[model samples]
Target: MSTRFSGKVAVVTGAAQGILRGVALGIAQEGGQVLLVDRAEFIHEVAAELPQGRGTGFIADLETYAGAHAAMARAMQLHGRIDLLINGVGGAIRMRPFAEFEAAQIDAEIRRSLMPTLYGCHAVLPHMLQQGRGTIVNVSSNATRGIRRVPYSAAKGGVNALTTALAMEYGEQGIRVVATAPGGTQAPPRRVPRNAEGDSAQEQAWMQEAVQQVTGSNFFKRYGTLEEQIAPILFIASDEASYITGAVLPVAGGDNG
Candidate 1:
């Protein structure tokens, strides 16, 4: 791999497993010092797996501003500067029709899928502003235009808007904000699943419907692999794509959501 991130300090949220873990590993492989953040204690395990001294772990509930601020503060204290932040702190907690969702469930979905990215960006902006150069890549989903998960879709839509607006406002300050709207991705079983409760038969059927719609919307009619989703995000975060900002690249076959 290329040392695009050589001499950089990167903060990756949701880094306990899945795409965030992959991103963190890739960053370290490319010579970036990485701080892995997640609410799970296993985040430390993931950090330990990286090359010695290349990775460190921070456990934080990024859904809250306080947690987000603390993670960024710790990164600054350790590295003295942060060059990149990959906000991967979201996933759909439940998948069902809009009407099937209770008010509290809808609120929960939004909180699960939106608050982290929102707060992460806000918390990191001051540091990036001080440095006068940084890149942020927010992970989004093509489900914004597909399926039964209306609340998750809305939340990712907010991420897209946040990416664009932040880039516009901070481009002059040397901060680049971008996002990747990935299709369904195939990865190892989650070390921590988003929802612990088992799905009922009806819930399974509703989720299947959402899955079918997502696969059908993409030209390949299949989910992407973790690496497929990781490349665009890393590219966007890299200096190679230095001129690119305020854009959401879709990594969903032909589905541009």
Candidate 2:
């Protein structure tokens, strides 16, 4: 309802699915020129759903530096300048106890939950600095403090560190960097199942344990809605939060982290 982003160009990664779809649409609805990025071809469909929308979709593997670089470059080419960036690509891919995780699984968890935010922030910094100002909102998780996916927790912790350090270092240059540590969310069922690891009996138990920990840690004992999880992210990206940077706001139902 607030056209705070009118005329702004926003690039949202992981826009192909889940709560990100809602985040991307919220940006478009607020009058930002939406550029959706995801590895899925269905990202184009998401772009098409924007209001007054001529969807600009970029297909990229955000886990790679080259992919992050290319998405930023391509968006700049099409829209001329990026006013906002929502680094929503990362997530916990597999849930398992720390010792039980295979070497590759550990590597995969780090890549899935940290590298994209790193690559994205790294890729966009120079350009935003050149333009004199911009905002970046990275999606982190409350699981950073709890869970079976220790690798994912570490990765999100890294994201939290990245957000604070970048904001402090660049605030004088008018750049704002922030992150949202969302609790469990009422996410739509994955369109493409993310890492089918729950098939085995032990794996299912691990996954179940992880889920219970997440919910139990929260006061509400339930998942936040898509709106509840993403509103703080969008708020931080808007001028309404112009002075708020270097902080990771917890969107969980009172998890103070």
Candidate 3:
């Protein structure tokens, strides 16, 4: 099939790994110039792995307005315009009981999950409006439908609200704003105990069990693949989905039900 993004410029935040990486690579594979933004040092490595000369990397913390502005400025300087934006920077913190969660924990969660999407939209919306067309896809989580993680759920729910509000505000200006909520997808391995100095076989086994339990919560009884999650993002960001706006396309494999 022909690449759907020939001559387009796409920006993807949190492009170091997982669904963000998938979205960035997918856009590049579709012939779009990509601006890969992430806070991790590995973001440079990941950006280098994209098709040569088609991608650029920016290391910035999306939790800050200055960082988000800088990333968007870099993209505009590199490509002149952003045709697509995939807001993919947010994630859940480790599970903790509501009563035990401290005020600082709530603050951190809100910053990590909401600031990125909000600032990203702020940075791109004006240029898109001026260009008279663009697509913005915010990556939310299925947790929004359930109280899996309180602060994270609240953040993603905000994302859904932002998507709809932007769509309604910009539909006449030719911008399409949408959200894609993915179900349980295979996540990268987290370091056991957060501060452990070495790996342990027993810990590994326990981690595996925990992962399995999480996946079991999904109706499909398996974690979805990165590609499967990216498919809906690509569709929503493409002209093929021109008529689609203010949509919350759940790529959750029926897990939200």
Candidate 4:
């Protein structure tokens, strides 16, 4: 690991588990002073498990304006500067054909996958602007070009768009905005699954079909590991990729997003 981020403050949303957990740990290992934000209290536990003085945690629902703002405010309060903002606050809430999705489910997907990035970027721009420098890496998905989860795909597409527009708008102010569209990524079984229950025979088939669609869409025809997905994101956030902005780096093994 490189101490490229030594003394920098990084804020990563969805820091409770899964990809975000791996991202938070990697950031700390690279010498960033990380602030883990998630809706779950377990975020605090993650912070506690970090090396002494390496991390802190904040529990907030980042999908909302108020929650996003509060998280940013707290980061500014603790570290006085937020050099990196990783908007990892998203996932497939449910997988179903577009027509099969209820109105509420579509709304839920957008809120889960879109609102956080939108709100997070909006909330943090003021601080980054005032400091005249920052880097943001929003998590997106290759599902934008696949099937069965139209709403989630649309939401991630929105993230890509957000990344491009923000980087263009703020490039003059010394802020770099980028996104990573990760493909199927292998990781530990979720500490909390995305859904309450979906293991029925039909649901299994639907879910499996979604998997097939995703796997086939990628040239590599396999999932990536947590570390594999985190590397590019960390690179894009670090000073090493200082000249790269307004770009979406796909970590989907050739599944162009």
Candidate 5:
């Protein structure tokens, strides 16, 4: 049997590493040509790891209009058409008290977490509309579920709202928009300490305990790996999920009610 995404073209933002890499690689494995977009210079390595001849990488700071436009343009230039997009760029900065969070921090959060997704969608929608079919999956966070950390929550909340609005507005054009809000994904690449000695065993134990505590609150009692989190993203982007749209699918271990 042929792969589900054979001959399709996908654009995955923040594809340099972590969950985004999983999503990109998953698409490639299914025979889709993937464009891996990221601001980090290491994106080339990530792209290379995808199925040979099935992936390419573009480096651009998607927080700016020019950057988002350039990345989209690059995908179009390479693939001639884009059928799927996974907007997986965004992260928390230094956590600060809600009351003490600076205006700059708020602005930065919006730019970092919301604008890139918005602009990428804007840049790609017209093309998808012309083709009369497309799927967009925005990466949100469990933070929106009252997880504290105000700025990050506010930004991801915007992403959730955007996904809903876009799904409704473009459903008539054969465009599907959805968001995935994952909670406490297993140790992110950038967060894990490099040297074992640098991270005390007690500290590591405390972190594991905290993760277990959080996971116990969810439906699933264990944290999800990057591959596991990528499953829903690929499903939503494929025709297999033809009837799904404007949905916020939470991938928390079990905490979501």
Candidate 6:
């Protein structure tokens, strides 16, 4: 693998599992010092799995601004500077049609999907501004155009807007903001389920519909692998994408959402 991240310090939120876990490991392999953040205690285990001294897992409820600020503060204390931040703390908690979603459920979905990225960006900007350069890679979803996840779609839409607006606002200050809109991805079962309650048959059927929509919308008619999604995110974070900012690259098999 390339040592594009040599001497860099990266902060990866949602590093306990899924795409974020892959990102943390990738950064370590590429010679970056990584601070992995998640509310899950398993985050420490993931950190320990990294090369010695290259990973430090931090547990923080990034859904809140205070937690986000604290996590970024810890990153600075541990590594002295943050060169990159990958916000990956989001997923569709409940997959069902828009009409079926209760007010509380819709609110929960937005909070789960959008708040972490918002708080993370708010907290990390001052540090990057002080250093005069940094990169932020947000994990968005192409489900922004799919069914049974209207709230999730809106939340990711917000993320895309945030990426573009931040890039425009801070590009001259040497910070690059970007995102990747991934399609359905095949990965190991979640160590922590997005929803602990049992899914009703109706819910399951709705979820299946959403899944079908995801794959069918893709030009390849298939879900992507973990690596496929991670590659573009790391590329945008690396100096290789120095001239790229304010862009949302679709890693969705040409879905372009």
Score residue 70 of candidate 3 by CA lDDT: 90
User: Which residue pairs does candidate 3 place in steric collision?
Assistant: none
Give lDDT tens digits, candidate 4, residues 43-75. 999998777899999989987999999999999
- Write the residue-wise lDDT of candidate 2 on 34-109 in tens digits: 8899999899888888886635888999999999999999989998889899999877777778998889989998
Which prediction has more favorable lDDT, 1 or 6? 6
Q: Write the per-residue lDDT of candidate 5 for residues 1-257, one digit (tens) a residue.
A: 33889999999998887888898989999989999998888899889998889999899999988888898789888978889989998876535446755798678778888899999999898789888999999999876754325777888999999999999999999999998888878756573222323545654564455455567777767777877788888888888988999999888765552
Go through the candidates in order and give each one's C-alpha lDDT.
0.92, 0.87, 0.82, 0.90, 0.82, 0.94
For each candidate, what TM-score against the reference? 0.98, 0.97, 0.89, 0.97, 0.88, 0.99
Stretches > 4 Å off in candidate 5: 191-216
Off by over 4 Å in 2: 196-198
Best by lDDT: 6
Scored by lDDT, model 3 comes in at 0.82
Which segments of model 1 are wrong by more than 4 Å? none
Pairs clashing within candidate 5:
218-254, 218-255, 219-254, 220-253
Question: How well is each residue in 178-249 modelled by candidate 1, as lDDT tens digits?
Answer: 999999999998888777887789988988998888888889999999999888888888999999999999
lDDT of 6 by residue, 64-154 (tens): 9999999999999988899999999999999998999999999999999999999999999999999999999999988778899999999
* Residue 76 Cα positional deviation in candidate 4, in Å, after optimal superposition: 0.9
Q: Which stretches of candidate 4 lie over 4 Å from their true place?
A: 197-199
Q: Indicate the residue-level lDDT of 120 in model 4.
A: 98
lDDT of model 5, residue 37: 92
